[model samples]
Target: MTKERIGHPPHPFDPARDPVHKRSKQGDSVGGAVVIVGGGYSGAMLAARLAERGVASALIDRGGDFGRGVAYATLFEGHLLNVRSARMSAVDGDPGHFVRWLETHRPDHADPDGFAPRRVFGDYVQHRLATVDAACPGLITRITGTVAAIGTDAVVLEDGRRLKARAVVLATGNPAPRTAPAGASERVIADPWAPGALERIGAEDDVLIIGTGLTMVDMLLMLEGRGWRGRATALSRRGLMPRAHGPRPDVPAPLEAGLLEGPLSGRLALARTVAGREGWRSLMETLRPLTADAWQAADPAIRGRIVRHLRPWWDVHRHRIAGSIAGALERLKADDRLTMTAGRVVAIRPGAASVSLDWTPRHGPARPALTADWLIDCSGPGHDPARDGLTGPLLASGRARMDALRLGLDLDDQGRVLDAEGRADDRLFVLGPPARAAFWETIAVPDIRKRIEAVAAALQ
Candidate 1:
């Protein structure tokens, strides 16, 4: 079969002359329409919302997994959502949307508070997209291919096909783990999420994971599913595991308006003070409504300080795991099968059978060299555009610039991509984790859904 180049030939729609609900003929394609560059959760939600508003758009992704980004693409039964089913809706105002979908589709596993498998969540997202596509017909076009560059008026695919669009949305999701350590590519697995990433390991092979965050938790779960009996070592700067989520309280803590106005230390101190009265979980929940505002209101220096000093602590408390996963982790620890260390890797040497690693503890002297059959870089995605494929051209062409933190692309409060000259582009928009530079909480589903709703409203 001949390969069809993946990209929607844009659909024609004139806001002034065309009926709002008019549906294009099947296979009819137009130009200068909305084109979203990623078909993951962000892009899927945005497209669905736009379709709900009688708008037409094209969704492009390399993997062609319209709703399942890297996060939910995992088929592992043991990998579950960190958030409960009740709060994992794709729509902004529909808190129970996902739970309702689960009831209709997978009733046996549809507990509102239970953490559903990531695959189930992926199914829910795909179902939403399918529902929208059926209702809107040709309004949502699915394109499967890599977007190589973002031109001023079009997106250039890897195969040199340029699809013109009036507006472009960069919902490209998270980056892969930093490139494997030099000369250790064969022994190091840079992306734990990649297909077949763990297929080469034997059941008893020693494994070293580079981070003690959610990714490491995922790796551990996958290993256990494979019946791995070898030792696993997780190393991080703080060696902190994500806290487990308990039953959410019936009532939330009172809002503290003053929390965002003070110095970083003062704000943290206030949070601690409140945590003393209401538990830490409640304090964090209370801060949820105000997180974006508080993050934006803080001085850049203060934000930097928070990232440098309190990030690890914040991460553990902010991104909690499921109780079941936590129990499994504890069991592994109890069985002396897992080790968590706080240290810095001094050097890495590749060997025929294993990789040699030299690490120094955070506070202690250097330890003896260690060896691992496989070293997985689970430190999460790096945010540098210069090092990324799609964004690199945008940066080189001055079409985009890095944020002050260099954690993501520079964007305005309205989610417009800013040029190298620091000017926001009217027709170019961005959502998802890359917008974290402007909205610190953009990585989560709730935040992404809100952003998608806003962007869709604005485009409409």
Candidate 2:
């Protein structure tokens, strides 16, 4: 295959004009189609990119919509994106693609620096996919179903359908939030993003949210929008809420060459010194582009130390909330309507009317038991690959292996999955959060878009 043909595959291999067989017969040869599991932004964007390049792909998702994953599926107007519009482009080379889309579709809210509602961004993603699909008709097939497992050269669906493909990309995005030890109960809302879960709470319900990160912020916004007059308490180990966004700082000067190579602790000390001079936010902004490189360079022991000691602080400062949302949260705190507690729930007793929780503070002894009319677990997405329904089976079957730190599926530099014996699979790949083990900064749109470009360029 020539360099030019890498993107624009020969017409004979075009699955668009000629669809791949639904199922492979015994002893059948490999097909030309690519199957992408997970219809979230990553998967959808990958399909669009492949389609534009004259390759054929099947995008499978359990959700009804193609691009509106859990993060963007919110209908609440208060669900604004954490990142500014100028930086949230879905196109790799075009940083202002999203802002341009906003100017055309929503002229009233076209400020490049302003945060747009996530739902609108979801619409923008779907629109882009539609445009690509129209341009390359039949190149991208949309399948609405859950993937049961991945075979050697095929994607098996939960409904018993099999799609034979030359390559399969796992873009399953973030897994569902981990359930609490209390188990399932009507009074406990395990996953706040679940359809109609928040709506079930009455306006007078006293709520206990077990997280203080972005997901916790989301829960607060949802409650405030519903005019819930009752008090709410958010608990976490460190009580570290995400900081609010502000004016973008100018890019800082490069770090010293010596600062970039050292133990994680030494690097962190360097970060502290820089933050003392330039401020923490500026340091975080400066570190954004360099995080993945630094992470990939670190040894597993260093990575483990970072995860155990610095992850929470890194998350709050790195992934900030919208300024408007921050102000609203502050107002609630000032009014004594919302409380942020640093603690862990030691025990949960479910009663007919309410749930009682015994929480132990970070620095103090166990506090008195508190009762809540409803309990919501917004502790964020689960991280264990072995716990994942679709990918778990692959790991058990020795088809895939977890990363050294168990942060995500083990993947090579090229996004190919590493098998149980530490071999990269040429025909299988992982993307987005599932591949976070290899690329620490793979979750954001800009990062994932660039990844799609690389993967598409490398496709055989």
Candidate 3:
């Protein structure tokens, strides 16, 4: 357990005492005793939970925008929450918490099944944090800066300042996607979600997007909202698009005893049988409760095969998009404004005003090179910590190690980060996307809220 250091009455955070503003000697301590790195959804929620438990903490974010994070920081109204509002409660053990908050805060979108804009959800998160802080003043000290390293009992900032912390929670969510191919030049938008990434492109320029998952769908929606007249081509290996949301079953479909206890192939076969009878949506929702156990129980070789060959299929079926969004995509394809191609990009050649790529079709021989005014890589967030700048310091110092599959950080079953020596560090813990390797179903709201509760219990 973490050393008990936050058992005193809370005080509001004073900017004058913030360690970043004033230089600190080797051991000068300041701010909340417990520090949380990353003010995004996971970090903010954890801080709120801790504060409610009377544990003061310092919440730090490089972007300085608390609660929004990458997922909810969007100004685009078209980017809606993937999950329905009824299940998006910020409070754990209270399923209707978000719905009640929505009725009071955003009545226009108060329907229990309606999908709220992500920005509104961001507002809700910020409001919850503020409300908790009001009740427990001085507990959450919000700091805006990039974290350089985490010491035994302090957090080092890039500006050479340090905040003394008895414990640290690395809630740095999704890292930016991997860099594009070498010499892809300025036409390649490596990360579409970056602020103003698509602003420079001409309205009529043709686009070639990599990947056909939800990120690709988001790009299309953003482009359509921008009133762009450009045509787009979404390229992927299997060209399978995300399934649309459907009516959830009143009762979860039952699985045979020990159905998921067998090999990966056997489990997939069972999934097919269930989908054929109860529909794909029912099959996916039913599997949610057991996915992590199934993932853990599988042999390492089977896990690798699942990732390489069946991941896209699993993702599309499990992470369904809103019906309206799916309809928009269908209309775009029907209008000849969008194209979906199944292929693999072989090489890229940069051009002065555009980018050219040579790719092989999934079924045919090498095809003619495709050229586009801009090549946007819509591949999802990168998970490797070693390549991430913020998480790199931990890897360099041997305080953290990557999982065997390189999905995310290596973590114990309790969500504590594992060091290079394969021992869990009590002073450090991980939550949300960074813990994906250990918890397969952790990225969604329902799963994340439960994780926050568990981590809060462990911390206290």
Winning candidate number (TM-score):
1
* Residue 375 lDDT (model 2): 88
Candidate 1 lDDT over 302-413, as tens digits, reads 7788789998998899888988899999999999989999988777677778987788899877788768998988887777778788778888899889888777888887
lDDT ranking, best first: 1, 2, 3
Give candidate 2 misplaced runs (Cα > 4 Å).
1-31, 181-183, 248-250
Tally clashes: model 2. 0
Poorest lDDT segment (10 consecutive residues) of candidate 2: 21-30
lDDT of model 2, residue 115: 88
Clashes of 1: 1
Q: Which ten residues in a row have the lowest lDDT in candidate 1?
A: 1-10
Candidate 2 per-residue lDDT over residues 376-436, each given as its tens digit? 8888777788977777888998889998898889988889988899998988898888888
Quote the lDDT for 216 in model 3: 92
- Candidate 1 residue pairs in clash (backbone atoms < 3 Å): 10-30
Off by over 4 Å in 1: 1-30, 248-250
